[model samples]
Target chain A: MIGIIAMRDLRSLFAQPLAWVVLAVVQGLVAWFFFSGVGRFERLQPQLSRMSDPPGITDITVIPTLDSAAIVLLMIVPILAMRLIAEERRAETIRLMYSAPVSMSEIALGKFFGLAGFLLIVVALTAVMPLSLLLGTSLDLGRLAAGLIGLTLLLAAFGSAGLFFSTLTRSPIVAGVATFGLLLFLWVINFGGVDLGPLQPAIDYLSMLDHYNAFLEGTIGTEHAIYFALVTLGFLTLSVQRLDAHRLQT
Target chain B: MEERSTLIEADGLQRFFGPTQAVQDFSFQLERGEILGFLGVNGAGKTTTMEMLTGNLAPSGGRIELNGCDLLDNPRPAKASVGYLPETLPLYTTMTVDAYLRFCARLNRVPKADLDEAVATAMRRCGLEDVAERVIANLSRGYKQRVGLAQAIVHDPEVLILDEPTKGLDPIQVREIRQLIRELGKSHSVILSSHVLPEVEAICTRVQIIHEGRLVLAEDVSALRARMQHSSLLLGGRALPAPESVQGIQGVERVERLDDGRLRVFHDTQSDTAEQIVARAASEGWGLWELTPERKSLEQVFVDLTGASESEVQDTNEEMAA
Candidate 1:
């Protein structure tokens, strides 16, 4: 069933002009960040290398600079995920989905994975960031691998969050706004001093930013990885329920 | 001698929206190889009924059974045998006609090995061969309608639910779609909803008329026609005797002239004795035209039986959707 849905999404994306535009814009941004990060790292290395670093240059320049890839992913995710469910509902294609033999779970997972596939390209385009480090500073394979793992999980969460918001409205613009707004709210909510102190422990575990920090330090924390996975699964599960209920109600 | 093939049996189905009742106490049954025309005026709960039966919208009360499988209890299994073509067609505008049907085929769980063959057959059957590669957005309205038909039948389900299948077609297109429905009726149990009474009469075997969210009548199309009090007359060739003179006949109650120049003479007594007038016309050399009994159009039958033609929610919805 998931294969059927993926096949449908893949064909739809390939055929739509809007999908092509989204793909091109995401790839352009990722490419721009890759070269710009490498250029900035090159210019900074000469001044910083002379001073004794707290950690090796691999930790200082490579891991930290490559973290820009995650930022690039953040910008690309909501755009790709915005159209997944919103457009389906707007176009009445959700009716077709509801009437199909496939379950709501299969539909959600297929769309999640399909959006992830497009987002993966944005993630993959940032390969130049790590490869550039290899050409100059010696690469830290462990940290880079850890960072990649973390980025994949983060992508899932972002995609799932976008998917859930997409379900909330029929307009892609609304889905995009809601997704980015939710993420921003999550980021800013922790800043309140009263809420931060009391909720800091739970906040850290729930925070996507903190979960991603583990990979930047060349560490693989199963707990952190699970946190991102849980967020992804949580939002996606909510999305499935929302859609199923909506289907049953109307 | 034959299988008791009950494709769909819906009973006491109702849908409410906030303060207003959309569909109330709706019920009907469709048997295999039976083409059932579902009739209602705008907002008479036609789409709502289709939605409930096809598993898109849940019923607020009552039950829908497909081949005896409870729709509310297990919608997927019940839906597996049903194909719904919504009034709007539910097409994916970005995909080509063929591609969309192939996608629908997969979604409907058609076997992988026969997917291509099945898609091809559905497209061909729906008269969508020439525009297979064109994006649905680019197709003409008539072609778009055919594509809707293709998608609905792509998986070859046993029960086909079509809502206003010919809502926006010219006369020729309507005729063509009617022919297609007749062909599909040979194998599938079809429940087609339309506001046009004549369309129901043209192709359907049984009809269920809903008025004000309730079942008005569910009977064979011919039976409904028979129940209508007034019988129509079919006159042909040159015109006949004067209206007053025809009305002056012994059994003649009223005589009205047709737009076609033929006279429609109504009678209450000696129904078979209209031939006496024909004989009189012939003997007097009064240039007798053709005289034949008029079959009431389905619209007249519905107007008579339902007694709520313009007021049904489903019928009103049929208009709004149009």
Candidate 2:
């Protein structure tokens, strides 16, 4: 049942021109970032050659490019995920699922996976820009793999949060704005002044950027993976519960 | 255990939106091969009741059983046996007609082997075969309605619930959709809601009139037609007698003089009032040109049953127009 709904959503998403436009914009930004990092690396190579111990190309060029890609994803994800459930409610097409024999959990998971599948393509396309350097220079394969996994998880978390916000209202614009607002807050929560008495560690742990930064550094900590998992699962469960409550409330 | 013939049974259903009760003490049963027409004014709770029956909305207090499975407790099995088309046509406009029906069939859990056949059958039944390849957004309103109907029956559920199926269509389209609904009724038990009373009278076997969230009237179409055999008679003549003289007749309750020099006589249902009036008109040379028993239309009966004043009915008509 979940597969059926997910496939339909995927098909519908691609049928619209918005998905193509988003894909083009994300790829264009990633290419620009990748080339700029490479240009900066070329300028520093001669100075680094004089030193006995110097930074490699992966540290200076690849990490910055992947880091900038994550930021780009943050801005585009809410736009993609906004229409997942909110458009269904606005068009009154949610009644089709409600009247069907499918469970609320199935519907929520189906929608989450649908958006996740589309974002997976976006992440893969963005990663291609960094991966192309392998033909000419040695790239850090392990770090790139970790970065890919981290980006996938981040998109999943963002998609789930967007799905939850979509269930709160029938307006896709409102859902998009709410998801962007919440995600922006979580992304920058760790940037507060470091003098907090006892809440600094907890706030640091909640920052999505901090956890994603660990992946870019090639250190795939279990704690970071668990944090992403928890956020993703938490928002998906809230979406399912909100859908179930819709039956009771108008 | 429920009777084998009963397809749907809703009992004592009540729903409230905050403090306002939308539906109260609503109850009805649909049997096999029955097309039950639900009649109501706007905001009379027809859509709410349909939503509850289809498991889209949970009633505040009540029990609903579809095919003997409790809707709230065993919704999957119960909902599997039913299909619903809400007041708003639910269509994914980006999808082609064939793709949309296929998706609906899959959602309904139609077996893989029979999925193609189910989609084709639904399309053929809804007269959508010609528009199968077209995107739903490009179709005309009537065709879009057919696509909505096609999706509802794509899985061939036992109970089909349609809320105002012919709502925004021209006369020809309305007739076509009504004919399609009648054909579907032969195989599936249907519960339809409509403000077009004649459409209900034309296709439904049983009629349910809902007013103020209550089931105001429930009767067989034949029985309701019997009730429509009104006791009033329209009397037209060149020279009519005084109203007091017609009131003097036995069983004649009162006489009303119309603006066109005609008498409308209200009489007891049990008495032979028409016969007596004819005899008096012949003897007194009243020059009666026409005397016909007035048959109350379904609209008049609906207004009388709901106790809606003339202006209120006028308001309802204007609301429907706009």
Candidate 3:
């Protein structure tokens, strides 16, 4: 049943121009950033060789592109995830689904997987830019793979928030706005809590960027992996609970 | 052996939204090949009750047995045996009719081996074959409604619950959907909710009327019509002594003048007042142009049982919701 709904959502995603447009726009911007980083690396190579220990191409070009890709995902993912459940409710088509033999868990997980599939495609598109360095220079495959894994987890966490917010309302616009607000709040919390003495460490630990920055440095930690997994699981559980409560409400 | 199956047994169903009791103590039994019409005015909780029956809403109180399976205990297999179409057509307008129906079929657990045949059969039954490849958004309102019906029956469930199946359709489309419902009643037990009395009279075998979230009347359609017989009389034409003279006739308890100058006489259910009125009119030298017995319409029965018009009740419900 989860496969059925996930396949349907994926098919609908590819059927519309929004997915293609978002993919194209985000890829275009990332490619421009990638080339600029490469050009800067080309110009700075002479000065970098003079130093005993110089910055490599991966550190200058690949890490920055990955970080920018993270920021781009924060902006584009809400648009993709907003329609997962909210649009169905707005159109009243969700009544058909809820009335069917499928369970609420299946519905939530199916929609999560559907959006995950789309995000994977976007992640793959951006990963290609970093891997393209292999044609001319020896690249750090381990670091690039670490960054890709982190990027996918980060998007999945954002996707979970989008899914959870979408289930909270019937309007897709509201879902999109709420999701963006949540991601923004999560993104800036560490900076915002800097002055709140004693609570600063707790807030910093909750910040998503803190965990993501480690991955950009070509390192993966157990705590960072656990944080993303817990965040993703928490929101997906909230989505399931919201849908179950809705069955009783409606 | 021609054995009928008992498809659904709902008992003590109750739903409350805050302090408003939407449905209370609702209970009924449905049998195979039975088209049961659920009649009520707007805001009378008809849709709420249908939602509970179809497993879209959980009843605050009560238990529903679908084919002997307790609904709350095992909803999947139970719901798989039932098909539902809500009042508002639930459709994915972006998908082509063929694709949407197939998606619905798979969601309802129709096996992949028989998916094409099931979709084809449902489309053929709903007259959606011509528009099967067209996007639902591009189809006309009538065709979209047909597609909604097609999706509901794509799995060929043993029970079908339809909420206002003819709403918002042109007369021809309404007639077509009603006909399709009647045909479905030959094999599936159908629970149809509507405020339209004529549609119920034309398609349903049994009728249950709900008012203010309670069942007020339930019986066979033929039995309800027959029960009205011998209780009312429609007397037309002029009487030399005036219309009130029919009140003096035996078995006539009340007489009122209709808009068309016809006399509407209420009498004891056990008596034949029409004969007495005709004999009295002839002897009194009255011009007896027409003396037809008036059987109570479902509308009259509805109004009498609910103590308000369907539209009026609907208005009150809407106001409360607002």
Q: Of 1 and 3, which scores higher on lDDT?
A: 3
Candidate achieving the largest lDDT: 2
Question: What is the lDDT, from 0 to 100, of the residue B228 in candidate 2?
Answer: 84
DockQ of 2: 0.82
Cα lDDT of model 3 by residue, B1-322, tens digit: 2443888999999999998999999999998889999987777789998899888889999999887777899999788888999988899888999999999999998999999999999999998889989999999988988888888899998899999898889889888889999998897889999886667889999999888899999999887667555567777776534556777878778888878777778888767677777778888777888777777655556567768768875564554343
DockQ score of the complex predicted as candidate 1: 0.64
DockQ of each: 0.64, 0.82, 0.74
* Model 1 lDDT tens row, A1-250: 8866776787677766766786677667656655565566667777767878534556655565557656665766787788899988888888888887668899899898888776676566555556666665577688777777777778888999999999888899989988987776654445555655666887756667777878677788998888888888999899999888775554
Model 2: how far residue B184 lies from native, Å:
0.9
**How does chain A of candidate 2 score by TM-score against the true chain A?**
0.98
Q: Give the whole-model CA lDDT for all candidates, comma-separated.
A: 0.78, 0.91, 0.87
- The TM-score obtained for chain B by all candidates, in the order given, is 0.84, 0.88, 0.87
| Stretch of 10 with least lDDT, candidate 2 chain A | A190-199
| Candidate 1 Cα misplacement greater than 4 A, ranges | A52-57, A192-197, B1-4, B228-250, B254-265, B283-303, B306-322
Better of 2 and 3 by lDDT: 2
The number of the candidate with the highest DockQ is: 2
Better of 1 and 3 by DockQ: 3
Candidate 1 chain B, run of 10 with poorest lDDT? B229-238
Q: Is the docking of candidate 1 incorrect, acceptable, medium or high quality?
A: medium
A1-250: candidate 2 lDDT, tens digit per residue: 9988998998888999998999999889988888999999899999999989988888888889888888888888889888898899889999999999999999999999998989989988987877888889988889988988998888899999999999999999999999999999999997867667698888888999999999988989899999999999999999999999989994
Per-residue alpha-carbon lDDT of model 3 for A1-250, expressed as tens digits?
Answer: 8988998999899888998999899999899889999998999999998999888898889989988888888999998999889998888899878878899999999999999998999999998988888988888889989999999999999999999999999999899999999998898887752487888878888899989998887889889999999999999999999998887883
